[model samples]
Target: MEAEFKDAEIFKRMMDATGNLMSDVSIDFNEEGFAIKAMDPANIAMVLFEAKNSIFSSFNIEKPIKISVSLDDLNGILKLVKKDDKLKISDSKNKLVLDIRGKTKQHFTIPLIDENYTAQKIPQLKFTAEVTVLSSLVKDSVKAAALVDDSIYFTVDMPRLIISSKSEEKEFSQDLSINDNKEIFDMKSESTTRSKYSIEYLTKFLYSADSEKPIKLSFSNNYPLKLDYEINSDAKMSFILANRLE
Candidate 1:
């Protein structure tokens, strides 16, 4: 397996997303694309990473391979690469090679692979409404809600979207409306659906956005929320954050 990236920062960002809730991940590299899936120990959240040929500057895999690795170790190794240096990874048996151009190459030996766990398939969520919103606005809502409680309430009404959280001592709410031009696209709400989710998990998901690019949100009452961040024109990365009702 050989892959190259022009900037190491992009690689760091992808690894950071996995480190939030997952310690280890099962990554599959095939002709179709690259995919990673891992569940938190408590089973409350799941993080997914995906990058396709269109997203990467250069993506080439002679054969498919699946490996389970400690995310922290990978991140640590990736950090060694300088800003402009290219990064490459190749696996053989129990050893992994980390190559940094214009610098000393490093080979890190990890534990033997354990192929015992099964990959959980993300369910096809049937959402009543889907909305497209700016990443910054979503990040702000999560940050504001974090001050009061660990959970946030997401409420979407056509032409307006609201994220609110309250505790016995304090309350906070963020409202984005079509009239204000903050919300880029608002879909008609089929039914008034509200659900509570962990602020930490939602915040991590928000960071997956590359820029002010639109994120697709799908949700149902008391059901898991799906947030998708499109990487390049052809690739997308998503997170399935479970709900904790208020």
Candidate 2:
């Protein structure tokens, strides 16, 4: 089996984001496309990544396969990728081969892990509130919260959404409303809902998002936070973060 991605940058970004939470990952490659599902070491967060065959420039596979790899090793090579570099992936004996094409052709092989891959079951969550806002706003909110505490609170009161953090001596807040904040495209809430989540996981999730694009947030009072980002028409990433209960 062999596959060629349309944009090496996109592939690199995807791996970089996932690596923030997980060091080892199993990638499932099939006729349709490829998918990756992983949970953070502490099990506080989970990430789901999927890319359709359409997202790849060329994909040739006779059968479905799952290859486990070390993100550190893979990312080490990807970090050297130039702007115009192209990437093709294939499998060799107990190893994953990376063929990078650019000014010169290069091949790098990394050992594949020998282990059984178990699929993680995504929690079925029902959210009372949903909001679509510019990704940059969410990223900034997380950054601000990091200065005060390790966790942040997300509150929704009708048309308004508030991101805040508090500690013994520090407090920070950023407010947005559908009617007033131009960056907030839409917001809906059944009632006043609030939840707290770890800022570290939030930052990792936002790393995969395009700051200029929009991201959807779903949550309920003291429930898990569901953040959805669309990389393109054929690719998507979703994150579920368990609430940091007080």
Candidate 3:
């Protein structure tokens, strides 16, 4: 498959979402769009990447393809790309070729071999409430929870959302109002459902919050928390983080 992006920087930003979570990733390119899915090392979390059409700034896919490679290696390869460089990826003789062209032209080769990687199956989640909040605020709440405990509690009400964490040492809580046009949009809470989640996993999951858009959250009592961020018309990325209830 042959694909090109106007600038390599955009591609770099997209790949950063994976971080060091998965050693192998499956990239699916089809007439619909480009999609990727991988589970974190511990299988407690998942990262999904997708981009469609011009929504990628510049994108073109000649044919459909699927390839698996180490996420860390792919990230290292993208680091070599410079600004304003056009990126071209192609599969040749079981190897992936990465070409970058702009003020400087560079080409790198990554050997591809079959690996025993099973794609993660996303489960159907029946969430009690769905809340839309500012990505920055969510990130800040997770940061605060980090200082108090490993697990953070999320509780939602109709007009307000609360995030709190407490330990033998101290407690931290942040309240956000839905009346103001701050970040929260519509919140529906039932029976005051609350769950605790690992702060470390939650922090890594918010790495893509720089988009300035609201992050959609869905949770149920004692179930996994779903965090979704839409990139554009083409695709939406989501994470399923398991909860650690107290």
lDDT of each: 0.74, 0.90, 0.77
Clashing pairs in 3: none
- In candidate 2, stretches whose alpha carbon ends up further than 4 angstroms from where it belongs are none
| C-alpha TM-score for every candidate | 0.88, 0.96, 0.90
TM-score of candidate 2 versus the correct structure, residues matched by position: 0.96
lDDT of 2 by residue, 1-246 (tens): 799988888788889998999888888899999888877888889888898998789999999999899999999999988887899999988999999999999899999996544688888899999999999999999998999999999999978899999999999998888899999988999999999999988988998799999999999999999999888878888999999896
Residue pairs with backbone atoms closer than 3 Å in model 2 (clashes): none
Using lDDT as the measure, the top candidate is 2
Where in model 3 is the C-alpha error above 4 Å? 55-63
lDDT of 3 by residue, 1-246 (tens): 667765566567667777745566677877666777777879799777777755444445567788766667788989977766678887787888888787887888887758565766777789987898888888888888889988898987667788999999899998877887467867887767777898888887788556477898899887889998875545577888888857
RMSD to the hidden true structure, all candidates: 2.3, 1.3, 2.2
Which candidate leads in TM-score?
Answer: 2
How far off is residue 219 in model 1, in Å?
Answer: 0.6
